[model samples]
Target chain A: MAPRIDTPGAAAQAVDQIQQLRTRISRLQESTPPSMPLETHPALAGLVQLRAGAAYSVDSATLALALLAGPSRSGGWCAAVGVADFGAEAAAALGVDLGRTVLVPDPGDQWLEVTAALVDVAAVVLVRTTGRVAPQAAEKLAARLRKRGAALVAWGEWPRCEVRLTTREPSWRGVGQGDGHLSSRRLVVEAHRGSAPPRRGALWLPGEDQTYRPERAVPVAAPVEGVA
Target chain B: MVVWCPDWPVVAALADEGLPSHLPAAVFHANLVQSGNAAARSFGVRRGMRRRDAQSRCPELKVYRATPERDSRTFETVLAAVEEQHPGVAPLRPGLAALRSPRRVRGGETAAAALLAERLVELGVWDPRLGVADELFTAEQAARQASSQDCRVIAPGESVPFLRELPVESIDDAADGGDAVSLLRRLGLRTLGELADLPAAAVRDRFGPRVAWVHRVVGGAGAVPLSTRTPPPELARHVDFEPPLDNAETITFSARQTADRVVAGLAAQQLVCTEVRIDAYVEGSDDVVSSRHWLHPRWFTAADLVDRLHWQLQGGFKAGEVRAPVSRVLFTPVTVVPDAVHADGLWGGTDERVQRGIARVQGMLGHEAVVQPVLQGGRAPRERQALVPWGEKPTGLRPAAHPWPGSIPPPAPSRVLATPWPAEVVGTGGRPVSVDARGAVLGEPARFRPEPGDWMPVAAWAGPWPVEELWWEPGGRRVARFQVVGVDGRAWLMTWESPGTWWTEAAYD
Candidate 1:
């Protein structure tokens, strides 16, 4: 013998509350879908985020391969556009899936159109710019990129890019005089962003084992006098 | 059952060139007469005659190059015409197709053939013949005997007697048909009956599987049913703009829906488009404004189709050229491959998001910008690396599996210089390091200078591995290779040829 409320208005009010509850439950479930784990290397730990709709500019193809290696190994599609002379074997040895990779060695003046089309499928696109891009064209391309959630790894300058990375003072190892083949290389990667303090890290572009690894300790160069 | 169009190659050639059948015509393959029209045959221009002999027989013989493409293209229409009369037409070859006896199509086999003949005549084929029998082999023989515009049918169970007197060459096996018949004749087996009468086991032992199969086929013991060819799927996907859009963005926006439809059509057939042919018609005109081919690295998805459409439309008009407003855009998948061949790998190839990202980038940049590396054969490291467009298989590349002569052994250099850096290698007496013709080091190498740097003293050096390439041709190359280790514990690969100068071709790292 709870309170007896037998009116059409009361019934309608109860139905409304139930409908409201159902909508709330659906919204909660929709907003909280399970998130996927991001695939990134320790060398580029915070510099580039996987699945983040952002453009990154890098100086060296070695670092570009290093950055793409993580996504490629984790079952992500990577493409190189207009970078005809990119070192593909190094990329393959770095664990990028050669089968999953696409290379457009040369795409002359119609680069912008090509890049926009590429974002429709490839997860990461590495493009080497040969000419300047109009501001309007860049804006349109960037907008589409953000909408599609595709990452751009520009070899040269890009308009309003999110991250700019550069590699300097690369030293080759495993060669003596005219003997032995080049086995590894060491480089320092510095990342800069708007108003953010630049971050620096040492990397083995391709270490002795032909893989991108964080440099354990910087090697000391012998003094010039000691070279005798 | 067999549907044979007499002198199809000649007929096809004549039709393609708009030549009247009243004129003598011959189609030659490899300079040997393949097919001759009735007019040419009347002039003693027979099949298997050399081109010169045929021309001697009929000086006015319209000599047309034997183009298989034109013949096949014309034959497709014939296939379609026959297909209209009956479904599941199994094309045996150009101008030849077969189907199961459609007993009820127009009352009986003869009636069906007559109907097909009537339809083919309507399609400009003058003399199409049809043959029906209990099995395919006898039916083909029956068709060969039928004259122009005629249909023949051998009653079931009567093929054995009918085939008994036929020549042994009637047993047609693609690989060794002619040779087997010749061999049978040499063995004194002249007729199909004589060849069929031989012991099956004995014939199989003597002639092999192909001839044995042919023997069984001629004896009416083996009957292979006609395998109906699946008709190619229709692939034209089009969109018409109501206002005849001039802006690239607007045109592409409308194209997205059409692209989805095209992809859906392909998916329904369990196929994927590898290449697309697009034809855009101008507003208020029937003429096609632009026609182009677009290749894809992977199977085209809806988004990929849209991107390609957008790219093509934007680049359709060249600089300083008057642009045409696109009234209708038609996308046809010119080439399709089975989906089973391109299904995703065990570890889903690439993330869907990643694929879209790369595709978007390619659209903005251009088609040739993105590339994937493929291993190829060559003596040098640079030559070994080949780039293929993403999603496309590498083709026409030197096989990497072959053992290339004079190629450097494995643990190959990690880095290769695009252009070899010229360097100096001096011996103890300061003479340039050289390799003699006998592949011997001229002198003990002392110091190596790479780009005027501090001369690093060579701690140890390997032999001069000589390479002589293209020796039979002019401008051949002869070079000697050496692996040198410096006092600083670094290694480099150096090469020297005639007029010796050590060039640093690659580094260990």
Candidate 2:
């Protein structure tokens, strides 16, 4: 549980908002609640962890995929895998406000700085990096984000954090679209913490009206950069 | 306490843009500055005279437009960079932003200024001039005197002495010279050094107590550091059309190009310009300036911009009107300002859509057709409102979220009523006395009558909301106004606000 304090100023307000979000996350299931705003809970929050050093041969990818397609009897928020492709189909994700997304430049000297700035701003931060971040810096950033009432949906490999999660590639059946457009692609994705896994259910292309009816599936890679 | 924040990015970008086109891009100072001594002044060079003119006059005036913005931004960056190394630094403005959290010692003021200048050179900011003093004004003066990165601290006990070495006029030598300094200069205290040397008795005797207080500036008194002013909300960008693109296609194309430049510039400033000045040149005559002002109370879209420039195309010399085909089209930013998001946060801080809609309505009906109400400081309705200039930086106009009291609401609009129809009325006693629409017994209402047919109220109303407009002069509207209640429960804000002759000024919408 997040600690409560009686401090004044912007930091205190940020802490209170985040704590409120953490407490509100209890009611959510496997699917996004219809007509509900993000004010209600941390349905989309992701707990990203990292190892001490940089290496690519870790099971993090499989672990992430398993989490995205994990089995949960309860329907809930889609396990979105964020990527940096502007032209990718995930640009039109259901229940996601695309305008809130931010595109960061590659991981050079300014990457960590930019990521830290983006912590409170973006819905998801797709960092294109091949190296691990220092432990203290990551912890500081996570604390800042949580306090700001925002979540860290981190892409790119990092060692570890304190949040537990569940992972699996649950089975999928019923693969078809009502209209002529071919839809539905099978893929495994991950989630952190003891949260239930995402089923292999299909997410449809968000139409002009912006609804996610799960009507069809299209072939698209996970939208996150430097990920599986 | 004036502060100058020469937008370094803007200055650098403009200077860079001017370079490819072979134009000299320097923000040169006016007289008394460049020529610190008598010799250059003998050559007839003034501070702000055009460079070529100065060059012709002095032949070696060392005429250089200042790179103040470079010095300024560099100064700020260096301060930040130094702050990163040493914990706390207090900042003063105009190339001398500092922090006194943990000051550098052993003559820390000078040493720190020098250290910051060194950091600036490392960052590739030019000339690294540094000045440190007890106050912002004197610190800036000290910095200007610095030829290189070495620190020049105005000694704590020696501030008056340090400032006295400079001329008294330099006290008001700020970017936008305040009038107080000018009045002081007119009183003939030529140099600050001289002024400080004068005795207080003599100083106050001839100059008076009010002028005496201003002398403190010459004495280098400390003041709260002034902040850099917020940027203006207007757009201006000049385009140099090469190959003399006089065709309509080229001009319209250039408009879009320059519009993009302005939009990009606004984004960098974190603001927008609701007005733009479009200039077109016939290319050969030399410095032919033709321009018009475009304004909106809100942001305009690319289409709105295209339309205005389209009207402007009629004025542009199309292949037929010039000795040389029109080679260049330019847009100069007159004013650009930050969009004040509603205090309520209804739009999530981006109201571009609403602004664009206003632009369209203004464009179609008329730019003057729609207006947001602003309370001018006057009692009369016309005097109550002066037109609002576009790209006006949001300042003290609307003091708070509350509506302006004793001021009429806007959208009463811009049409003059046809005539003030008069009326005469008989009271319940059926006597031969006259009553105005307001039911006050008057001589007569000039052109109106009570109708047995009209189903309006006959409630007794008060006499004149009297107003006198230019009544002392030969001709003016002296009128009175009052409120009348109808039998149907409708109340009208009739004008007795003006004295005798009456016109309904406004209604509660």
Candidate 3:
């Protein structure tokens, strides 16, 4: 009394047809939040804040390490692309959970492609652009990064970045003559934005003993109670 | 009931090479013959024979290196074929498998076995054999006896008599871990009947528990229980194309559904796959075009599976290369773990979005591009941490708990210099500070100069802790470490290797 099973392969084909439809539907229904916000760094307080769908620039590796460490330690995924000279030890020292960090030491000619791919996965992507990027390519990558809700940490220059950190007058500490070690350095960091006077502050790039500590006012010795 | 494929390693190796089964083929492992086909065996090529000797016996024998993967993959296909008829077919090994005795057919056990042999033949297997008995041991013996027929059945009580005529060597290998058969032969017990006739307690005391097990098996007194396991449905999924499309996009697109189904199946069973074997087959052909085993950090998702396939198609797979892509794709989950143990912790582990993002990036870049940091025990800051690919369980590395003598004490350095920089330490008279062989400081270190900076006097300095490593070796090294604090409140861990040579190892924040 049952309808004749048409071609023996019909059942299999129908199963395949149903599966394709399901995949398409599931993909369409998938929607991710526009951005995954990261907590702002204390040192870069007023100047830099982490938000996906935008680009941020940093001048020093030490600041970049500090900026990345904050989010990464809180369980965000970070990636470094085409930054061949990145010091893994320095990143680790600054509290960047290297466990959550991905490094593409060299992306060669596929820097944009690599960055684009990284944007889809990593919450924060640090790209060291080697040369001038085509305006079209940059626009496309920026749009993709925005759509994916990933922040791009540009090592080199980037146009219209949400925040730009530039280090000036860097002074090394701890070392004297050629005998001691370079323990830390103090840098005056200037944050620049569109049509805004650059905000400047002084802090140890990596404070005394390889830490990112805000510059503290050294208590004046108070004339040492007549010791002189 | 047991169904066994004899010399399966040779069969599988030959099948992989597209060689005829009738050829005089013998597989070798480590220069010794492992399994030889009937054609090679007839020419005196035996198991464990040295290659040169086997070659002497059969000059025209085609030799092959052992490949366990091929054997396993082929046997898995055999198991799949058998599972179609008998659901709970438990694989004993690559060449041997057992199943629960089926309900009697119109022609009884022989007819049932004939049907099995017929099915194996249809799958291109020649001279397949089957045996049925109450237990696995006697059933295996029945299968061995059925070598000349399609099937053999040992009636319930006939197992003892059937086993009696056989040599004691027959039951020897299974029970005793060693060569119990040879020992029994040395003891003048040629037939299994003689071995079985011995008092059970005497056998147990003389030959240990294993021999006692053998006596029970042969005497038909003990039937070891069979662990009947059926392959889970989620273990495999396959899709076929009518016209055999060659386009990678189309093939992968079609495979997405199958992958999703496979993953969903595991999820339904509260399991997740850690490893999976993907197979691609050309239209109308049993020969696999490409096959690969992908390892995952966590359970595989549909997208992860699809990404791996696409990567492979785009030249990621080099060995057993997929020269032509047409027809069908099969995904087989090889390793799986329970889902209960894998659930993310509350507010601790990565969220689903994070997992997705990382996987996407890894897929785009390459598998090894993303790495996670793991703390490991070591003497120096540089050696204290290791980087492992994200998602993989960290293994095969030094444990962090081991107490490393001479390692820096608490208040671990905030950052470690990947490459140590050279520096110099001088005393008050501008004398380059040095440590003597007896661990005594040569000078009171005063001025510190790491580079071309102005000389800064050391405010406070710690001991010259000398350490001698690998002293028994010719390339031994001795270094004296010192901690110095500058007026700038910067601390540096400096090491003096020789009289005038100093290296700044790390800075303590």
Each candidate's lDDT (Cα)? 0.75, 0.43, 0.75
A115-210: candidate 1 lDDT, tens digit per residue: 777766666777888777577877887776666566778887887877788876666665544455455667777888776888677777667776
Measured against the true structure, the TM-scores of the candidates, in listed sequence, are 0.59, 0.31, 0.61
Q: Candidate 3, fnat value?
A: 0.19
Which CAPRI tier for candidate 1?
A: incorrect
TM-score of chain B of 1: 0.64
Superior candidate under TM-score, 1 versus 3: 3
Q: Rank the candidates by TM-score, best first.
A: 3, 1, 2
Better of 1 and 3 by DockQ: 1
Q: For model 2, how does the per-residue alpha-carbon lDDT over A1-228 read when each residue is reduced to its tens digit?
A: 965555677678887888988777854532233222122111212323221111111122222222222111112121121222221112222222322222332224555555555443333233435467787776676555444333343445454532333322322222111111112222232343334453243322222233323334333442322421
Q: Which prediction has more favorable TM-score, 1 or 2?
A: 1
Considering lDDT, where higher is better, how would the candidates rank from best to worst?
A: 3, 1, 2
lDDT string for model 1 (B273-296, tens) is: 998988888877888887778777
Task: List the candidate numbers ranked by DockQ, top first.
Answer: 1, 3, 2
lDDT of candidate 3 at residue B134, scale 0 to 100: 80
Q: How close is candidate 3 to the true structure, as a TM-score?
A: 0.61
**Going through the candidates in order, what is the number of backbone clashes in each?**
76, 84, 16
